[model samples]
Structure formats: C-alpha cells, structure tokens
Target: MSIATLSATPPPPSSRAARRTGRLFALTGAFVGVVYGYDTGSISGALVFLSRDFHLTEVEKGLVNSILVCGSIVGALIGGKLADALGRKAAMLIVAGSYAVFVALSALAPNVVVLDLVRFLLGVAIGISIVAAPLYVAESTPARIRGASVAAYQVATVAGIVITYFVNWGLSGGGHWRWMLGLSALPAALVLIPLLRLPDTPRWYVLKGRTERAVEVMAMTDPDVDPRAEVAAVSAALAEESGGSARSLLRKPYARAAFFVVGLGFFCQITGINAVTYYSPQIFEEMGFTGDGQNFLLPSFVQLASLAATVLAILVIDRLGRRVVLLCGIGTMVMMLAVLTAVFGTGELSGATTWIGFGAILLFTAAFNFGFGSLIWVYASEAFPAQLRSTGASVMLTADLVANLLIAQFFPSLMAWAGAARTFAGLAALALAALVFASATAPETKGRQLEEIQGYWRNGGRWPVAPEPREVSPGPLSPTGPAGCAERGA
Candidate 1:
C-alpha cells in the first residue's frame, strides 16, 4: 500500500497503555545516551586535567579529543551494515560490549597514545549506539508519539551530559579525570540488561523475512496500530527498492533524502556547538570566569539548560512540527552567534556585557537542544524508505561526524589564530548557512507515518504528497500497552 492509501483514514487517540508500551521500547533504546552523553561531555573538564598529565601540545590535545569522533565514523559505517544484518538489538549488544571494554581501557591507559587509541575504540561503541539506538526507538514506536520517542534519545544524551557536568564539577577539585572517564563504563554496560529483554525492532524482523516475529514485536510495542497494516506498510516501502547499501543512497528517490540528512547534519555541526561543548571550560576561562571551579560549575548549568529545553521540545515537537522548530532554533543561534562575535571583538566583556555573553550562550544552548539536538535524530529516522534507513542514517551520521571531526581538530587552532571574536564570526556565517539550508530543504514530518514520510521523498522531495492526518475520536486498545523513552542519541 502506498502512504496515500494507508493514511487515508485518521487514527483515533491511543490508549495510555499503548502509549506507554511504545515509549518503553524507545526509552530502552535511548539508554545508550547515558554513556554517550557522559563520554562526549566528560572530556570538556577532563581535558583540563588530562593535558596537565600528558604535557600535551595544543595539536595533541585536539587529536585526543577528535580521535574518538574518527572511531565513531568507523562505527557508524560498520554498525549500519551490521544492524541491517544481525538486527538493531544485536548491534546494540555489540556497542555495549565494546563500551564495557574500551572505556575501562581508556581509564587505565599508560600514555597519551594508549589513551587516544582506547578512546578511539570507545568512540566505536558510541558510533554504533548513535546509529542503532534512535533507529530502534523510531522503528519500535507508534507514529502518534514517534517524534517524542526519538527525541527521547536526545533527552537521554542531554541528561547524560548534565550528569557528566556535575561529575566533572565534583571531580574538578581533585582533577580526577581518570575517574571521570571510567565512570561512563557502568551506564554503557547497564544498557545490556534492558536490551536483553527487548526484542529487535519489528521492521528489522520483517526485513529479515521473519513475519511472525515482526507481528509479535509490533503487538508488544505498538499495539495502537494494527499489526497487519504495519506489516503491509513496511512491505510496501521495502518493495520500492531492495538490495540497499551506502552507495545505493546516492541513487534517485533515495538521493534527496540522503542530501537532506547529510546537509542538515553538516550545517548543524559547523555551527560550532561542539566547540562550546568540548571546550567550555577553556571558553569560560577565556570569558573571564576565574573563580574556583566556576568553569566547571557554569557549564553544568549550561548543560542543565540544554536538558530542560530538550524536555520541552519532546513535549511539543509532534505538534509544533520539525521545520518550524529547527528554523526558530537555528535563527536564534545565528543571532546569538553574530552578537557574541561582535561582543568578543570588543574585548570589553567585564560586568554587564559579561553577563550578556553568558545569556547568549544560554540561548544558544536552548536553541540547539530545542531544534538541532533532538529533531536531527527524529528527521534522520523518518527521512528514508525502509530499505535504506540504516544505511542512510549511517551515511548521515558519518557526515555529521566528519564535520564534528573538523571542528574538534581545528577549533583550538582557529581560536589561536583568529581569536574568539573572529572564530565566532566564522561560526555565525555557518549558522546563517544552516538557517538558510534548513529553511530551503527541511520538510515537516510531524504527524506522518513512517511509510508516508518515505512517500514524501518518492514524490519528488515535497511534503503533503497525501492528505494531512486528522485527530479523531478515541478507540478501544489494550490497557496493558506501554510507550517509549527519550534518547540525543546518537
């Protein structure tokens, strides 16, 4: 069935139980974010102490920070392929196992080389988690709350970052960077227990020719939707094309989805969010917060702001829609970046204007979490047809990681050569680009079924290929049905 046919009639409101059921599947997948957020943010404070221990040059510090992203690229490529083969559940298990080993190894490294190498391996775990976890949530849940479900991944990630910021603050006094790095192992390992109980996504089951199993899993996770209908929808999407791979994403129909995801991710990263995330302490220090532990302390609040905004985003994304939220956020970022760039150029950020800079960063954090942080995963999960979902996610995330790598590697040098003012000016230019790109290319995916979303791409990259979904009256559903969790996943 084409999306126009499948979605011709509106769905009634899902029962509380069904909503909870889908959320269970999504949140379980989202737990990977705990480790992902912690690992990603831990370095911000840890770098301060780690550099002291390693006596590292500026270039080496960049290398240490960026090597993990390189591993993530590798992991995305490998994990995307394996998730297609073994299943999302099995791929997550692999991610969990790698995190268990490599994080411990990272904690116990004997030298900078060992630390860099081990961190690279840990990044592989993160890479796989990013690819698999959000995909799991999106495929496992009902379309009614799919936006919230996928946003759960981002929620978990921001929550993880919040936890790490506090951890970093607590450990900063003693400079216990090793303990900070090692603590991520527990959450990374803990994801296994829940994943063990959960089934692989129904879509993956159907793709693997396990019809009976697919129906069974859907009944458990998305009881609000009829199993037969979902199976047909997946079959139709799969029928459109087969034998997909990374190369296949470049072909017609799939090509536009590929470009959209890759483009969104590229612009999102180039906005220099990670420059703040990875080096906030240094940025804070440069911004003149020289109090005891203020660098660590303030960024914790910044992470908290991001966490709160992500939560708010989760509650309303399905209603307010993706493109509007993204444009608003990116627009805020462009303004904040331009103003901050000008402020930094003045070199007079003492007293009142210093607080203005702080407010601007806070706005930037909220704007990012509100749009780019959460919706990126949501959009990536829904953009492609079933045959290429995993491959497309991998390619999209790989492009994201590539841009992330460029920032991690060169940000310090950029800071050195251009100074904060010009560096932010450059980012402001990129943010303007991101805003323009999003306005031009991002199609709203809210309230659309997975099959319907693919239909949008198939019908020449335009939305509303079919009629809009209507909110209808409530209907009877299993009271025992549950919903999914929040994961920035990936």
Candidate 2:
C-alpha cells in the first residue's frame, strides 16, 4: 500500500498476543547483556588468581584485562556493517557462538599471551552483541515502553555482574580462577539457545523489501498495530536513506546525531565506571580492605548497589525522561568522586576514613548505574533512523570501548603515579564536563516513536513542524502530505 493510503487508516488496537511477543523478544535480547556482564565481572575476580598462577607483571595484568576492550574496539568498528549485512538476529547468533568458544578457551589458556588473545576474540563478540541486541529490542518493541525495554538490557547486564560476584566469592578460596572464567561459557550458551528461535526484526524485513513478512512480524508483536501502515512508514523511511556507510553519518543532521551519540558514550566511560567495575576488589584492597575475605565481600557490595540502581533506572527512565536522569546521575557521581578524592588524597587509609571511602564507592556506583550506565545504550539505539541505527550504535559503542580500553589499561599506573585521590579528582572533572554537555544538548526521547525521533533530528533537533496538507510530492520518498505525521502519531 502507498504511504498516503496507509497513513489515512488508523492503527489497529493493541492485543495481548502482541504485547506478549514484544516482551518475549525483549527478554530474549537481554540475554546478550547477561553474557556481557558475566564476562566482564568474571575477569575482575579471576585476575587475582590468574596473576598468582601465571606470575603476571603489573603491565601484563593490565594487558590481560584491557585486551578484550581492544578487541571490542575492532569488533565495534565492524559491527555496524556486520549487523546491516547479516541482519541483527544473525549477527547476534554469531556473537553468542563466538562468546561460547572464546570464553571456554580463555579458561584453558596455558599462558597470559594465549589468554589475552582469546579474550580479545571474545571481546569482538561482545562488541557485536552490544550493537545488535539493543538495536533489535528498540525496533521490535513499541515506542511507549521503548526506553524501559532497551534499559532491560542494562538491568540484565548488572544482574549478570551481581551473579558473577557471588560466583567469584564462592571460588576465591580455592583459587579456581579457571572455573570462574569458564563459567561464563554457560551464559553464552544460554543466550544462543533463545536466539535460535527468534526472528529478525520487522524493520529489518522492511529494509530488505519483505514488506509482507515485516507486517506479519509486527502483527505478532503488537496486535493493535496496523501492519500495513507500519510497513508504509518503514518503506518511506528506507526510501529516504542516502546510504548506510560511515561516511553517510558524517553528513548534515546525521553528523550532529553521531556527535551526540559519541559524546554520550565518551561521557559514560570517562566517568571511570569500568575502572571501578573491572578492578573493584583491587580498589578495595587499596582502601585497606586487604586479605581474601574482605576483598571478596566489599566489592560485592559495590556491585549490589549498582544492580539495585540499574533496577531503579529501568523503572523511572521513561517517566522522568533521559535528560533529567542523566544530568542528575552525573552530578551525583561528581560529588561522590570529589569525596573519594579527598578521602584518598589525605593518606587517611585507615579506620573510619576507609569506611567512608567504601560508602562513597557504593554511592558512586549507584549514581552511575542509575544514569549513564542505563541510558547510554537506550539513547544510542533510539537516536538514529532504522537505516543508520546499527552503524550509529556501533560508532557510539566504539567510543565507549576506546574509553574503556584506556581507562582499564592505565588505571593502575594512574593510581600509582598520581595517587588515588588525584585519579578520582580527574574523573570528577570529566564527570563535570559530561554534566554540562548533557544539560545543553541531551534530547528528550521518553515517549516518541523511533520514526518521530528521526523526524526530530531531521528538523534540526526540534520537533518536526506539524504535517501540512500540501499536495503529495512525486516519488515514494516524498513527504506524505498531512498524513505523514499520522504514521508517526502525536
């Protein structure tokens, strides 16, 4: 059906079947987050045992940890093209399989070199999953709950981390780092099983010119949605695509969106969240919580706080809006970091001061999880049009990987050279900058449909002017006259 014809017909009412289908896809997609969390969290605890077993130097230890991020950088660089060419579901399946293989290999590594190489390969899978899972969730779900659905991935990620902490604690006594690392393979296998049954998203089908199948999938996911109307909207959007290359993102309007996505990513990582996540036990040790028992117990508390905060973000992100949560979260993080800097800088690493530092770490984790940690992927997944969503997310995630690599790789040296206080002060400064950038430019995408969000960017970051009843222009890509807005809705 033509865009004009489809737009004139009102959307069908939503049905329980459709909502169930959407929820299923969302939950399945979140398994990718579990794989990610397990891999990341498992490493932090494993590092201690791995270091003892392998006799790893400080620099070598960092490499073992940072190499995965390095591999993820390459993975993200190519993830956009892979997702676009292979389709999101196919790409994610590949990611899950790769994770299964490499994580198992990481457990068997005879030396640090083999471990680093295997971890990097696993990272590539992580990079692809990061881009594909959220893209699929954003496209399959309805706009009203899009933010919460996408944030579900983050919730699952934190959940995975929390689970790993307990696993690490259980295994820490025996120094069974191999078992800790190998356990990640279980989640990767779990993620793969569900993906085997899932379908490629409707938007993807439309992009491939399979309008009938697109409609069928949409019907299954949202019984109330008018499939034909949605297909027309998809068709119109695809027709407007200049190309899907990275170069295309450098063009007008898209360039701005790319910058915004990248900035969001940079801010998310620069705040030192990964440093804390990857090395929380080490940090606790530095703060006078030495010995095996204290190290295992204290860091778990930090992760628990993160897990709770992520749940809070998922509940309230759509209601309070992205900008508000992000700004507030980052601002709170800055205060916590400043307090940490003061505590660490004064060389008061004993008694009440150490306890205060522990509290500050928990608070920092809470704030970061509530804001940027949850919103970064949600925002990236929704910011661009369907044609560019994969690439846009990859670009944004690549920026995150870069920040993670640098921070993870250099955190120890930074702490050693500059001291923990100075290191924290530096992060606090970066958080302040993120707060400013988000305040001035963050878009409110709480309730808008994905296409409406595109229209907002197309109209230069403001809402598109109300659709006027002008004559429909020639060609499929031309404006759909007054009914154009009807497709996207109020």
lDDT of each structure? 0.81, 0.82
Q: TM-score for every candidate vs. truth? A: 0.83, 0.84
Lowest summed lDDT across 10 adjacent residues in model 2 is found at 2-11
The TM-score of predicted model 2 comes to: 0.84
lDDT of 1 by residue, 60-129 (tens): 8899889999988888777766788999889888988788788888888889999999989888888878
Q: How accurate is candidate 1 locally (lDDT)?
A: 0.81
Per-candidate RMSD vs. true structure? Answer: 9.8, 6.4
Rate residue 241 of model 2 by lDDT: 62
Report the Cα lDDT for residue 74, model 2. Answer: 81
Pairs that collide, model 2: 13-224, 14-224
Per-residue lDDT of candidate 2, residues 321-377 (tens digit): 998888889999999999999989877599999999999999999999999987887
